[model samples]
Target: MKKLTLLFIAFIAILSFTACTEDDGFTFTAKPDPEGISFMNQTADTYTLTSANANNLAERFVWNEVDFDVQTPINYELQGAAEESFSSYSVLGDVTDNNLAVSIGSMLDLAEEAGLDNDPETEAPNTGNIYFRVRAYVGADAGNVVEQTSNILTVSVTLPEATEDAVELKRELYLVGDATAAGWNPDNNNTPIFRDAENDDIYYFEGRFAGGDGVEGFKLIESLGNWQPQWGINEGAATSSDILGGDPQAFPVSDDAFYSFTLNAADGTYTFESIDASSAPTYSAMGIIGTATTGDDSGWNQDIDFTQSTFNPHIWYINGIEIFEGEAKIRADNDWTDSWGDDTFLSGQGNNNNDPNIVVTPGTYNVWFNDLDGRYLFIPQVSE
Candidate 1:
């Protein structure tokens, strides 16, 4: 009888649980807030993107907080895309707050992708419009959650040309003065410094230099017969360290040693490091050969002999030579025994008679070749 009574009590409990919500005393239900998400910040019609201020703040997007009538956390995101399109939008930022800040660098990347540039040579328009908007969603799955989007805004962007104060890096530089074979004469067929193919502001040269005895120094000139834009350090000391330039004064050689040199035209600075060349090979003779040079036979049968540098046994140069539009190679003894050609056409090793021929453009040029590293350069006499 006690078991029957217990079973009866359990049956009543089960009925109560089944009928719980239908006759419950009270309940709570979530409702969407009518005050939807929207932008609350003033925006400009146009903005400029520049490398100088790349890291600086460009814009701050502010929006009103969104409520889905829930106590849980809310997620916010800022998006950008080509004007009027979100098919390929980029999430510029995501945060819990109602505001997000963006940098000029980020916008610059977008402008580049939009085919906008500051270069005058390009046909791309410097000014173009991009779209931006903010989104508020309640949960991770924005599609199934109470999601609201802010009004899309258009922003005109412009990439201004480099400023007037920007430094101009010339395409070529020449070594001259008492420490070099040119001996202070600008027109003496000075050795050409190799300009970096990837970076116009950087230059490099490695060869023999004389004079650490205090009086010998050198300077760089842009053209063979011109010296007004000369570059050299003010101090005449010879030692390896950081260097300053811009003055017509001479940079000291520091010692009668083989040195590797670098100059940064953008910052008016240079460096001279004395390097050991004991392991470097010196060829008996090297000259320009291939279709780029000329003789009666023309193409590969001709050779333009290069003058061996008196300062270094492994360095050779040819001044004011017309390098025709063809392929060229620097070889030893008028033959291909030891030949150098680089795909970059800037520098590389001979690699056992294997390498790509140096591409040439027709121009009157001063050519310098370093047998030590198989580096070569061709500098035009006149700007083209």
Candidate 2:
């Protein structure tokens, strides 16, 4: 009787151990999903990235931490697409933290890249919908990954007009002196200090310098190429930390290698930094010289020069101009070295400088010249 009772107790203990093992062996077949992913601080209305708030923080996207039920770190990536299908998307960045902060400049770039027109002015403003999604993944690396994407969010974006700010916006600085290609004449042949097309207040100049020592001095001037307002080393500042106007000290360089100069107009400071050979754009500025007849052939004989659009070096524009069916052409400094015209001037199709002069009918028109695509357009407006 004692032996039989002992056997029964051992069998019951074995059964309890088996039940515990089965309960602990359960596993999840799929990776965990991130919950409550959203734009925590985004505005409901269309966001505007203007000159005033370009550098400000634009948006913060937050999401709850996901648990993949595995002993590994999870990676998060923020992505955006022009369409909801997300056939192709741009990755804003990756973050291990639960929230991601994006700048206004970054958002503007994404909007423009996704086909938002930069034109600030129109009867109907240019805008488009941008979709955003967050993707989370886990594994040692991308090779052994299990990824899940969040629900899509749509946002409307408006693009600022390029020409609207082209005049008032000081997006470029020119280096003028005997040391520069312009040779001390701010009004002629000035070498430009370029700013990123999307960036504001930061300018860059990369080129060979023949002089930087005391022999030939260089000053920074706005695109007007005038010396009235200029930038130079501040008085009694350490290592040229500040820029000042009114007969300021010129910047000195080593002049050993091709130099790159960066001026932060926003901070009122400047720096000399090294740059790659292919860092800057090689596009040249163009001038428009043409004849517009409102009354007697008054302006016909004179060469009317168009100013370079402040936002785009390749774009030239003439605003509020009188036109009476005459002739017009685009040229460099009113010289035939580089010029453009069209036999079919009424048609918007682009033509090379070698083409004939464009014929027009009498009216006031706003002209736009695009050197990037060799295209030109004439839009008529009521005289004011």
**Model 1, runs deviating above 4 Å:** 1-170, 234-248, 294-298, 345-352, 382-384
User: Candidate 2: what lDDT?
Assistant: 0.59
lDDT of each candidate versus the true structure: 0.72, 0.59
Q: What is the TM-score of each candidate against the true structure?
A: 0.50, 0.34
Q: Model 2, clash count?
A: 8
Top-TM-score structure, candidate number: 1
Report the error of model 2 at residue 246, Å.
51
Q: After superposition, how far is residue 190 of candidate 2 from its true place, in Å?
A: 47
Inter-residue clash pairs, candidate 2: 119-161, 120-160, 120-161, 177-184, 325-361, 325-362, 339-353, 340-353
Candidate 1 lDDT tens digits, 145-173: 66678888888888876543332223467
- As for model 1, its CA RMSD to the true structure in angstroms is 15.1
